[model samples]
Target: MLNKKKELYVAVAVGLIALGGAAVFASQSSSGDNAAKDKKPPASLTSVTISDQQATHIEVVPVKTYDFVEQNEAVGYIDFNQDATVQVFTPYQGRIRQVFVKAGDDVRKGQALFSVDSPDLVTAESTLISTAGLTKLTTAALERAKKMLETQTAAQKDVDQATADQQTADANFRAARDAVRIFGKSDADIDRLLQTRKVDGELTVNSPLTGKVTARNAAPGLLTQPGNAPAPVTVSDLSTVWMVASVSETDLPRMKMGQSVSVAVMAYPGKIFQGKVNNIGIAIDPATHRVGVRSEIKDPEHLLHPQMLATYRIRVADPVQSAAAPLNALVREGDGTMTAYVTKDGRTFTRRAVQTGLEQEGNRQILSGLQPGEKIAADGAIFLSNMLSLQSR
Candidate 1:
């Protein structure tokens, strides 16, 4: 019985040994499979050899030169063209009797913008009326004295004294008339005032030019002084506007007067405002490390407003000759580098990294990693990159 029990224990131990070996073998097999799955091809394997059938799908062309002009971009704001703007202020001190126009109102040359009840005009008119009455009375007295002298009823000295009085009155009336004219009274207006013995004290201030009003601080009964702050009205010719750009100081040397600029604004999407650099700031801003570049943009429609956000691009340099690759010949890699599929034998293509510059037309300016006359995949480069990535993985 003891021998049988020992044999039974030996059989159980052998079965347990076999089970342990099988488990170990299975574990090793699983680890080998995982390692094979995780293995990646060498990164140096960037070249791909394809059959003629595959080569037919890719459009390969020789690299050529392109004319590229460097441009500087900047953000800025829209503003009024100060050269065409004017502040309309009353020339004389008076309480505003009437404001004929408000902000945003269009005005023409010689159009009355406002009227002032001027006390100076009133005083001038009063003097003119008194002088006119005195002249009429003195002339009648002189005529009576001349008639009486002819009849010997008055002495020659009396006649001479009346003539002198009449002459003095005439001179005074002429001076008063001149004074009223200075107050903007026309000849006809003065004549009518003389006939009616009435005065029009309100003075009309006319616009100096054709423009649209930009601001209005004038109201009825508002006291205004000459050339004061917060001008009663501001007008500007809307045929043009200003685009002010803050350009980096490093780019200041590139900016020049009369350089053409293309501007865009958020308010008008897809519309370009064409302008030219009219002024450049003499001093750089210490806070922003930038300089102000002002451009005058034609705005015939008067659509641009002050303080609108805008952006602009100014071509600083002339066009330069450089190698250009077809736009589709390059592909952006996952590592953020640009890669082009280069080929010497036409069927065997290799990935070449390149540095690019301005993209104009359908070509990209190749600054480095490429040469003119080299064969590159002009199209279907993205396909090659995808195939290469899949095979490498």
Candidate 2:
């Protein structure tokens, strides 16, 4: 009975091992079948058939070699023409008496922008008064010495010394007058001040250009000096604006001065601002390796503002020979490959992978994998791609 039991146990162990092997084989076969079902067709083999009604909606165009201008794209911002932007600073140190203009106020050249009560002006007036007094005294002394010399009561040396003193006094008087003039006072005003001996100690600031006041920092009783931050006022002439863009090193050769440029800002969609290249920087940025290009755009309506984000398109090529298709016909696949659908017959569209170059003005350049005379699906390329994706599944 013990021998028979050992033989039966060995037989059961062998049966169990066979069953496990069969199970693994069956699982692998099932996985292989699934993988076959999931495999996708090659791009060229993918095709789609649409009804006549669907065909009516699709646009078709022939790939052709075009002699058209190539456009290069860059991003940049709008800036005030620095040549027309001015920061106003007062030459005299003083306390602000009044502000005549506010931000955004249109001002003319020589218009008063603000007024200040400056002790510096008072000091200048006092100096002028003292110098005039000394001048008068010296003149009288010189006359007395001349008369004495003529009558032989004083020596010629005394008359000569007195003449020198008068000359020195005259120079001091003129310098004092100039010191007041530097504060924007007129000669007539200085003459009146000397006669009246009354000083106003008030200085008014004027605009240097005909522009809109962009900033104001003055207030009553606030002390101000030259070179202060947030300058007393800022004036900007907005008749013209600058659009600055960054061009990559690779695209630098295509850029040239006086080339026409089109600028678009988010604030105004569908509107293209016209401009021309004014300058291109020779130095490349160490951090970005990009060169700067500046375009001068006329803003007659003052619609553009400083620091506004803008898009720039510059025409680099002039009627160059190249192969291209309408931008609508290009499709981007899931594998990051660019493709376009071509057709030998109207009913069947074959997808072709293409290497692409620059895209501009509603057209894209095909570097390879496309012929000049081939017909492509221009409007419904995306729809065909979507249908092919569904059929593969």
Candidate 3:
């Protein structure tokens, strides 16, 4: 009875174990099927859809006809015309007593700038005084000798000797008077020195031309001498200014005298100044391989100055037919090349390499690789480029 009871219990335990194992295997199989189904790519991500309006957000431009002026670009500098610059130099050795003018001062012609204490001027004055005194003596002696000769109270040789002495004295007086004049002394001052026998050490320095003082090299009490460094003053007339441009030889033929040009300085951006080509060089510089072109600008208000850097654009007289597009149409490729997209149809964009010209009046000129009346991608070019890149990938 006990063995039969144990056998029944074992059978029940085996049956329960078999059922539990079967249920566990079935659950794992169902989980594997679910995982396999989930492994497939999701339906929502299988494709990308973009609306026509969203695609159109990539802005576009149209090629249009415009009148483009051909221009030659060159870097240039502002300079005083050679005819307008004057270098003032000392005429003699002297000590500067006072300087009345500073650099950048506007002065008129013959305006006194400073005074000099000059020993040469004193010597000139003394010589003039001595010569004038001798002149009076010689004149009296000549008159007496002439009278004696007329009255037959003197010999012919005596009258001739007295006349020769008078002439020598007269020549000496004239030479001394001229010497004083050459020393920059006025005639009235020379006469005063002769009458008073007193020397005036003050020598006035005057401007030779009507212009502004551009340089000051001497100070009060400094010695000014000839053959030394230049005088303390430099003057220039700024009413008319010159712009010097170095143009390539290839562009030389396009330039002509009296042609209108434009100039801009970095100091004043977006402000263009107008000028006329006044001169052109016949020869090219061997080192730079460029020709010098000079333009003259009228500055009545004296706004322009010397040595300022400027950019010049010379207008060529050639008739130009140009194609233009909006600024947004420009695309920079990875290799530093520029490209633009032309829409063959309203929906398709074709990339084209374009050569660009000068940008003027907010529009850029298309030199080549584009036709007028074509539609171009004016904005969101980067998005278009990325799309193309993705398509290629």
In TM-score terms, which candidate is top?
A: 1
Residue lDDT tens for model 1, 1-393: 999999999999999999999999999999999999999766756988878888888899999999987889999999989999988877677889999998889999878888888888888999999999999999999999999999999999999999999999999999999998876678999999999988878887778889999998989898888898899888889899999989999999899999989888888887888999999999989999999999999999877899999999998988899999988899999999999989998888899999999986578999999999999987789888988888787
Q: lDDT by residue for model 3 over 177-279, one digit each (tens)?
A: 9988886777887777877888787888788899999889879899988767676788888888999989999888888899988888898778788889999
lDDT to native, each model: 0.90, 0.90, 0.82
Residue 387's lDDT in candidate 1: 85
| All models, RMSD in angstroms | 8.5, 11.8, 9.6
Instruction: Please tell me which model should have the higher TM-score, number 1 or number 2.
Output: 1
Residue pairs clashing in model 1 are none
Model 3 C-alpha lDDT versus the unseen true structure: 0.82
Candidate 2's C-alpha lDDT?
A: 0.90
> Which 10 residues in a row give candidate 1 its minimum summed lDDT?
40-49
Query: Could you give me the TM-score of model 3 versus the true structure?
Result: 0.63
- Candidate 2, pairs of clashing residues: none
Indicate the residue-level lDDT of 246 in model 2.
94
Clashing pairs in 3: 60-378
Error of 1 at 139 (Å): 9.6
| CA lDDT, candidate 1, residue 253 | 87
Error of 2 at 250 (Å): 1.3
